[model samples]
Target: MNNLTPERRKGRKYDQVLEGARQAFLQDGFDGAGVDDIARNAGVSKATLYSYFPDKRLLFIEIARLECKRQGDEAKSIMPQNLPVRDMLSFIATRMVSFFNSSLSLSIFRLCVAEAERFPDLAQEFYRNGPLMAQTKLGAYLREATERGELNVEHPEFAANQFAELCKAGIFARLAFGVDKRISPQESSFVAAEAVEMFLARYGVTQD
Candidate 1:
């Protein structure tokens, strides 16, 4: 008799719609995918899809957000820093770059950008999920390292942004242009090691 309990099933419908919508966008890209296709895939009617999402663009954007959130969750689960902060940072950055290089991450970004103007809402939502989450979470980690006397940071948020830029330097841009086939093993190590050096020079303080 409890309406709001798990047995009540308040968000199952929306969850199903989002799952189907994400799968469709990933498989077909936003432009190539259709609302009816998503509806049918979810076993829901177009009317139901409309009720769940105001429009196809919104649905695609939501899917992008969901995927970004899932990645954020994974990143947060990384082991906390006990070593030199630079080493920890390198570990996280290397893992992050490899994660982004995956085909699925590249495809969602391409899909979002290709239709960004047509659906500014989608673009904005994607920003919240990707850049915003990445910076905030990584910044928190850096802030913690500073409190532990492992690194000295003036602004953890800015530190996080710079660290990410270093790791991603020219990598995503190259991906955007289809100039490379993902960051190779050698390249990833080079980037990670160099970024660690850069981060330490900027944030680590030498003993007096």
Candidate 2:
């Protein structure tokens, strides 16, 4: 027997329901779906669905989180330690820009920003789960560089943030204004060089 609260039980039920809802949401945009349709598609009761989430907003955001986690993993693929940090970060920045425009990602960004006033937590959660996660990974590399005395980073995490922010300026800014552009390979190389230059300037072993 499960001892979870009604809300929690609904949350669990959503685990199953969400798999279906995710398929539906991806196949159909957010505005095109219905609560009953999602519940029906999930093989759950309307009451059960409502018990966990009073509205579609909460449920959609959770789905967005799941989607963001997938994006985080993809971003991680760009940060292989076998490669140079500048090469890796430049690859990461371009990938980040490209990913923000992914159908689900762009939608999630819009949803979170649109509801920022009503739900600040969602915005924070998106950041923590997405870019913040990327920064932590990047910070690990910076920490390694610091130990080697290649980059004199006082705070690896902060260094990671600065690096990521500088690199993402192109793609992230576009997401904010409903613009869509795919980054090219040539562009990635250019941005990667500049980002590497910037990171070196901020925390190089010795500034020239």
Candidate 3:
């Protein structure tokens, strides 16, 4: 089912096809999901689906890219400026962990793991759209924060990756494997706080 609601089930033709493809891929996996099933579910013919996507791999990449953009926009929208360093970091980390805990995100992670060997380009696309893009934005933020004397990060890229990793610790792996489908807000907050604390410990100007 992939947990897509009926409300999300209806949309414009292009979105309908993308949503159907997402459901098909998640439910049946990349290799197992048939284009016929995807087209039928989308209320489009195979020809229409092909016209839009050309190939299943391209469809999957588009889905991944769209999701990544959505996540990035969400996190960016909530980002606070002129706040305390810890507060800003906490806000960012919480949003990130929340997205990582989502079913759609987990499904994408699973797809990359399951199909990467057979479809290396697909995996690379996901990586670039998801984690690599996030790291780039986070690194830019870190650089700006450093200039304001909120921290002392010499390597913003490395620090961004470290912060993201710390926020995902103890949660992302478990969620991806189905050990936990939903993480409580309390737990997410705790992890976000810990990530901020550790990051500040390493980079704060006052830290010994």
Candidate 4:
């Protein structure tokens, strides 16, 4: 899904470089993707490519950041401010699970895991733009829910992180290892339901 608007992603040559880099990284993996190949595929001069991204790692990191931000934006757009706590949590969890289960997301995650030790900064950049941003946004939502007396969360940040983890529960490891990466709607529903239940059990307030 092309989440980026053409107007916002203007500049024909700039877009070409990013598109070329994305294809190269996805097809060849980080280690195998070359700047020269990216330039050739992009149909841009080496100078043009370098003008946008100083190094290959920077290019790859930017791509990862863009994709992660896109996913987050999509998820955020659907987060309802008026929904009940359980319903909102369920919605967020389901959206996150869908994003995480995608082939593109899985590929980027695998690359981050494999290269994190050598390129810690790149991994940090990925985390900041992806999971960390999600957690922060979710924390704000949880805080709002608490203010509305829907939940008993004392630490919204911690609760947010835990909810996201609960959503990933039995699926992330399988995805990382390339085992049963595909998730059916039924499976996603099950995970989202369980995650919401567990999260509400911990933080939801009940009227006696």
Against the true structure, whose TM-score is highest? 4
**Can you give the lDDT of residue 184 in candidate 3?**
92
- The C-alpha stretches of model 1 lying farther than 4 A from their native spots are 1-63, 79-81
Q: Model 2: per-residue lDDT, tens digit, 1-208? A: 1121123444567687787678667655476567877887888888877877777866787788678677667666645666665566556666654555455566677787787777676666778778788778778877887787667889989878787777665656664564643445666556657777887877776636
Q: Write the residue-wise lDDT of candidate 1 on 94-113 in tens digits.
A: 87677556555676678668
lDDT of 4 by residue, 1-208 (tens): 1321112333669888988888877666565678888998899989889877777766776688677667667756756667777777878898788867766677678768877886665567668768898899999988988898888999999988899899898988886676874778898889989999998888889878
State TM-scores per candidate.
Answer: 0.66, 0.61, 0.70, 0.71
Q: Write the per-residue lDDT of candidate 3 for residues 98-123, one digit (tens) a residue.
A: 87876667767777787777666656
Candidate lDDT (C-alpha), each: 0.73, 0.68, 0.78, 0.78
Global local distance difference test of model 4 = 0.78
The order by descending TM-score is: 4, 3, 1, 2
Candidate 2 Cα misplacement greater than 4 A, ranges: 1-59, 71-79, 181-193, 205-208
Error at 39, model 2, angstroms: 12
Q: State the displacement of the C-alpha of residue 109, model 1, in Å, after optimal TM-score superposition.
A: 2.0
